[model samples]
Target chain A: MSTVIDARDLTKEYKSTLALDAANFQIESGRIVGLIGPNGAGKTTALKAILGLTDFEGELSVLGMDPRHHRDRLMREVCFIADVAVLPRWMRVSEAIDFVEAVHPRFNRARCEHFLARTKLTPSQKVKQMSKGMIVQLHLALVMAIDARLLVLDEPTLGLDILYRKQFYQTLLEDYFDENKTIIVTTHQVEEIEHILTDLMFIRDGQIVLNTNMDDMGERFVELMTSAEHADAARALGPLDERHVFGKCVFLFDGVSREQLEPLGELRRPSVSDLFVATMKGTYE
Target chain B: MKTFSWLIKREFWEHRGSFFWAPVITACVMLALNLMGIITGEVFLRGHPSVMVDGTHLDMIGHYLTAEQLRQVGAGLDMSMLSVTGVLSTIMAIVVFFYCLGALYDDRRDRSILFWKSLPISDRDTVLSKVISATVLVPVITIVVGILAGLSMLVMVAITATFHGANLWTMLWTAPHPFQMIAHLLAMIPLIFLWALPTIGWLLLCSAAARSKPFLWALAVPVGAGIIVSWFSLMGVFNLSSTWFWQHIVARMLLSVFPGGWMAYDPSIFQHTESPMALYDSLSLGHMYASLVQPEFWVGAIAGIAMITLAIFMRGHRDDS
Candidate 1:
């Protein structure tokens, strides 16, 4: 697969604080990569650098073009929903569509209109008149209609209810995602998007802690649940994180084979959320 | 070109109130007042019972006046149309000033800048769109509205003249040089736009750079400079009078509408001409064009371009989020 985003030793500094510190990663096309990080973990900074919204020290390229220099040119194929409520509140739905159609060559107005037809959004409706869920739906409808190769969504569903959040991802997956497109998303609610993410990158303190495919996660990491008697044997294998559940020890091991772990205790694949917690905790430790 | 057009359209969309609606409302109010004034004047004349002249009462003034005296009255009426145009111009200037000051700052404050920046449009295009909207589009809209308001006022006066048995064409339209007056007013707008560049550019720069209170920021810097210049003058360093700063900078802000001092319009036109048409004729477009090569014009243009370029840079580099 061809790489859509390649960042080598990317560094961004805001005065004394290093927001992105030699961060290195490559995102190939046709993968839904979740950039998971806590607040101030440089997730937004990294995304900004990639989107050419900010300058950075190392080399970064999106779709074979240097984003810093060819930002306008690069934007032709890259669509982004930076955050919730980014659309101007005073803008009417029709004006918004007209604006995107005029400026973006890849935008399909008919497709956007088709998507909006399914929602409660009308052409005359202003953004401020819509609820948070409706706003997200409108934004999503606009974004999904663009035939962009890369779609970077930074906390796209940041402030929506569970129903809307579920609907957002469901609609995106059903209507927007295809094998030819690449999506990079960041959100606080990791569990909500974990099922759809083909790959995940865990970042902390401007550094990547974990970068692996979702399918490979089970082979590389294991959560072993065992009685107190077998807990010491499970711990000998150097689990990355340990916790107690219902009077039993549940140890999360990274890179330990399941065959070896199964003999000592019940081995199960760790959920993405659990893996993320383990990864972050390991970094702190 | 398409992107630039859309960018400009977006600007109008965002600032429709200040750019379009405010001037339209002003024109409507001015028209309404003109109609009210004409009706009140007619009612007062009828109630007071002026002497009859040719089947209509014109005894208070028109019947007794000589042809020359009537012409002078006509001139006065014509000059009032110019005054209306001036009032509309003043209103437009004020609207544009505040619009320039807030254009860049408002989007960033509301976090709408993120959405704008996400588009394929460059920062240069974005800043230029705001500049053109302020300098070109706003003035054009104001000019159109001003013309309509002027016409409405003249029509009301013409109707009043007919009621008084005075010749409508001679008393109102012909004396005012209605077409010439409008042409002159329309011609002045482009010049005013060029002349007001420095102020517009400074406001835009402040709008882009200020994190909060753009008004205070735009005001404080110039006032601070004036204060320091005054202190230096007190020390007898170079004999720099405060009026020099006021004339060169503060006065230049209003110079677009009121061209005086070095680039002054001929005061003789007001003194000599009884006809507003003659007043417009005496005013030389050549002098206005000559002022283009003057040091003040070039200095202001260069400074304006520098500030605008800096604004573009700030918009590109600053991450407001």
Candidate 2:
């Protein structure tokens, strides 16, 4: 796979804190990479740097161009929905489409209209009149209409209901994602996006703690649910995290073989959220 | 070029109320007032015929006045129409002043700056678009509306004069020097816009730089400096009155945007010469255009460009939101 984004020792410092600290990662084309971290963990900062919205100290390239010097040129191939409700409230739906169509060379007005036709949004509706779900749908329609190489979403479905959130990802997966495109997303709702993400990068304290593909996650990390009698034996295998559920001890282990874990208890693959929690807790670095 | 055009269109979209609607409303109100004044003047004239001495008003020095005096009276009426337009333009200037002060700052306050930045347009284009909207587009729109208002009022006055048994075309229209008046008004727009550049540039810079309360920030520094200069001068510390910062500031605020002090010149010429034609003749497009080569104009233009460049740089680098 070709790499779409490459960062080496990327760092951004604020007056009182270092938002991103020597962070290094790569996003290959055609992969939906989830950048998971708690609030203030520098997730937004990293995305801002990638989008050329902020300056940073390091070498970074998107689509083989340095974002700092060529931000406007770079924006032609990159699109982003920075957050929910970023659309101007006074702009009518039609004006938004016209504006994007006029300014963005790759934007397809017909495609955008087609996307909007699927929802209750009409040309006359202003952004302020739309509900949160409608706004997200509008934003998604505009984003998907752009023939961009990379789409970065930072909390795109924030403050929406579960129904809209589910529909948001569903529409993205169904209509937008393809082999030639790459998506990098960061959100607090990790589980909702876990199923669609091909790879995950866990960041904590401005550092990437874990970087691995979803397929490899099963082999590299295992969750063993064993009775209290065998919990000590499971613990001996260096489980990355331990918790109790219904009088049974659940231990998450990394890099321990399934055969070794099976003897201690029932083995299963840990969910991305559990893995994220374990990773953030510094149990496995 | 296309991106810049779209950016400019976006500014018009956002500021349609100030750039388009305010001047339209001003025109309509001025037209209404002119109509009311014409009716009242006609009633008062007919009811008081004795006030007309020797077939002309006693105040007009009887009927011994020559055609030159009659033409001057007609010109005086035309000057009133121009005054109406002047008032409208003042309103437009005020609208544009606050518009420039808030143009950059409002987007950041409302968090819509993100939407604008997400486009493929550069910061330089965005800043330039706002500047053009303030200096060029707004003034042009106001001028168009002012001209329309002035002409409509003149037509109304001519119709009212006809009802009063007076010759409409030669007396009302010809006396005003309509072509010269229009040419002078048209020339004033670019001159005033250039003269006001320093204020416009400073407002935009403050809009870009201030996190909150941009109005206060834009005003405080200049006002504070003026106060310091005055305090030092009063205390016999130095003779800095030659700097004329305070004089220029007041002029920019009141007089610079006007053409050749016409607002002040109008009433005085009308009082002394008692001929609106004399006032019309005094309104010189040549004098207004002559200021284009003045040192103050060049200094303000260069300073305005520098401030605007600083605003662009601030917009690009200061992404606190």
Candidate 3:
């Protein structure tokens, strides 16, 4: 598959803090990659660098062009929903559709109308009149109509409830994603998106701590739950993280085959949240 | 070109209230007041039984007035039509002034710039859209509304004149030169644009760069400079007086956004004339374009372009939202 984004030594500074430090990564097409990170961990900053919303020192290529200089041109092929409620409050629904259709050459008006028809939004309704979930729905309808190659979503569902968040990702996967498209999302609710993501990236302190495909990650990391009797043996295997749960000891092992871990305790595949917790452990301290 | 037109249309959609309704409301109020005045005048004259508005009144006017006096009355009627439009222009000036002040800043303050930037439009195009809105679009809309309002007032006056036993169509309406007045109004738009350019550029710059309260920033900077300049002049520190600096820099940067604010351009446009037609010709496009010959216009135009360029750069680079 062709690479959609390639970055080398991408660094950004804001006065005294380093927002991105020598970050290097490559994302190929047709993948849903979750950029999971804690607050101020350079997740949004990295997304900004890719979107050409800020100035950065780096050798970065998005869709075969430097996003910093060709931002307007790149925007034709790349779509983003920068948080929620970014749509102008004064705009009516019809005006928003008219404007996007006018400027975006790839915007499919019929598809946009199809999406809006599923919601309660009318053409005369102003954005300010909609609830937060409705606003996100309108925004999604607008973005989904555009035939873009790469979509960068930064905390797209940050303040949403479980139902809205679930519907957001469901709509995204069912209606928007395709073999020719790529999506990069960053959100604090890792569990909600963990199941949909094909690739996972964990960032800490302006660095990528772990980057791997979900299948490989599942094969390499195992969560072994054990009683107190086998806790010593699990520890002897040098598990990456150890925790106590409901009078039982759980040890997370990396790169240990199932046969080796089966003899010590119950072996199960680790969830992305569990691995993310293991990777980001001690960051707050 | 299609994208640019849509961008302008987007601006209209966003500011429908200030652009369309504000002028419409102002015109309605002025028209209503004049209609009320005419009705009351009719009632009061009728109440005074001797003050009859029949053929006798026409005979009295023809009997008491000379041809020169009758001609002056015709000029007065024409002047009244022009004057109502003059009011509409004032409201237009105020609307354009505040609109420019908030053009670049409001989106940033509300965090809506992100949505605007997400589209394929360039920062240059976005800023140029604003330039077109403040210069061409708003003024054109106001001019159309002004002409409509002027015609309504003239119609009301003709109705009252007809009631007074005069053929207003031949005697009054013919003297007004409505088409000439309309052409003159349309022609003045370009002058308004040039004179307003400096102020538009300065306000938009503040709107882009100010972190908070762009209004305060736009106001304090020029007024503050004027105070310091005047203080220095009071101390006799410079060869030129403070008025020169205030008129050349401060007023150009602030008050030029007001309609027909090229007052510094030739006060002789308002000079007493032999007739209302002469007065109309004095403020014609020829007299207005004469200001273009002066270096001040070019100096302000160039400075305005520089500030606007900087504003565009700031809007592109500064990602505070």
Candidate 4:
């Protein structure tokens, strides 16, 4: 796969806080990568840097162009849902469609209208008159219509209810995603997007801690549930984390072979939520 | 070229109420008031051998005047037709001021700047759209509305004169005053744009930079400077003059957005207008073109261009907002 974004020593500082501290990562086209992190962990900062909405010191390239200098040109091939409530309250739905069509050469007006028609939003409806869910629907309709090579979504479904969140991802996957495009998303509701993500990244304190594709992750990480007798043995084997559930013990291991882990007890692939909890165990403190 | 036009259209869409409907409504109100005044005057002069039939303005005053005096009356009549514009332009000044104060700040306040930035449009284009809206679109709409109102009033007078058995209808079609007024107002647009840029640039800078209350910031800077200048001059701290600061700096920063606001500083306009007819004769396109060459005008215009450039940079770099 060709690289979509490549950054080496990407850094950003806001006064006393180093929001992104020499972070480095490479993303390939045709992958849905989830950049997961806790609050204030530089996920949004990194997205801003990539979008050229913020300045930083480092070498960064998106779609083979430096976003810092070519933001307007870069935007021709890149689309983003920066925030759901960001659509101006004074704008009408038709005006929003018309503006994007006028300014964005890649925008497909018919496609936007098709998506908008599925919703209850009318052409004359103003953004302020819509509910939070309806706003995201409108935003998604707008972004999905653009034939962009890259799509960045920062907390795209932040305040939405479960139904809206599930529907958002479903629509994105079915209508917007393609092998020709790359998607980078960050959200606190990691579990909702877990199943759709092809790759995972865990960041903390402006540093990327984990970067691996889903298949590599499955091969490198395993969780084992053992009886009381096997708990010590599991710990002796140096599992990354160990915990007790009822009278039984569960141990999570990183890069420990499945063949070696199988003889101890029942083994299953860990859920992304479990991995995230285990990985970010001490972040709050 | 197309993108620039769309960018301007976007601005018009957002501010049509103030930029368009405000002037239209003001002109309509002026016409209504003028119509009411004429009907009331007709009622009061009923059966009194009204001046309307007695060959009005000339017959009553012509017997007591010279040829030069009669020509002055004609100029006065020409000038009076455009008097309603003076009121509308004042209202236009307030509308444009508040619009500029909110132009950049409102998007940041509501976080819609993020949405706007998500498009391919650059900060330069976005800022230029607003600048053009304040300088060009506002003046054009207001001028058109003023002309429409003046024409309607002129027609009403012709009809009223005809009803009184006078052939003012022919005079109405023949009068060059309405066309002259339209040409004068149109010529003033470029002057308005040049003089208004300083205030528009100042307010836009405050709008893009102020965390809150841009109007207060825009106001406080110039007024505060004036106050400090006065206090310093009182103490003889420097060789500063307070009146010069208020007249040259503070007034231009606050009042330069008005149509012909630059002429307010020109003593010639008031000194010669001691006779009403001379006001029309003295204020011409040539007089306006002359104001363009003044050192003060170019200095203010250059400073405005600098502020506008700075505002563009600030809008792009202000990430916290």
Best by TM-score: 4
CA-lDDT, candidates in order: 0.80, 0.80, 0.85, 0.85
Worst 10 residues of 4 chain A by lDDT: A268-277
lDDT of 2 by residue, A1-285 (tens): 799999999999999999999999999999999999988899999988888889999989999988887888899999998888788888989999999999999999999999999999999999999998898899899989999999999998899999999999999999999999999999999989999999999988888988999999888999999999998888788888999999999999989888887878788889999988877885334
Residue lDDT tens for model 1, A1-285: 899999999999998898998999999999999999877889999999999989999999899998888888888899889888888999999999999999999999999999999998988999999998898898899889899999999999988999899999999899889989999999989999999999999999998878999989868888989999998888788989999999999999888887788888788888988888877764444
The best candidate by DockQ is 3
In the range A133-194, model 4's lDDT, one tens digit per residue, is: 99999999999999999999999998888888999999999998999999999998888888
Where does candidate 1 stray beyond 4 Å?
A282-285, B47-77, B170-176, B234-239, B250-290
Return the lDDT, model 2, position B284: 50
Note the DockQ of each predicted structure.
0.78, 0.74, 0.83, 0.81
Query: Per-residue alpha-carbon lDDT of model 3 for A132-172, expressed as tens digits?
Result: 89999999999999999999998999787888899999999
What would the per-residue lDDT of candidate 1 be over residues B5-39, giving only the tens digit for each residue? 88889889988888888888988888888777666
Give chain B TM-scores in order. Answer: 0.82, 0.83, 0.88, 0.91
Candidate 3's residue-wise lDDT over B61-134, tens digit each? 43456676565555555566667777877887777778878888899888888888889999888998998898
Which structure is stronger by lDDT: 1 or 4? Answer: 4
Better of 2 and 4 by lDDT: 4
User: Model 3, stretches more than 4 Å misplaced?
Assistant: B46-71, B171-176, B234-238, B270-281
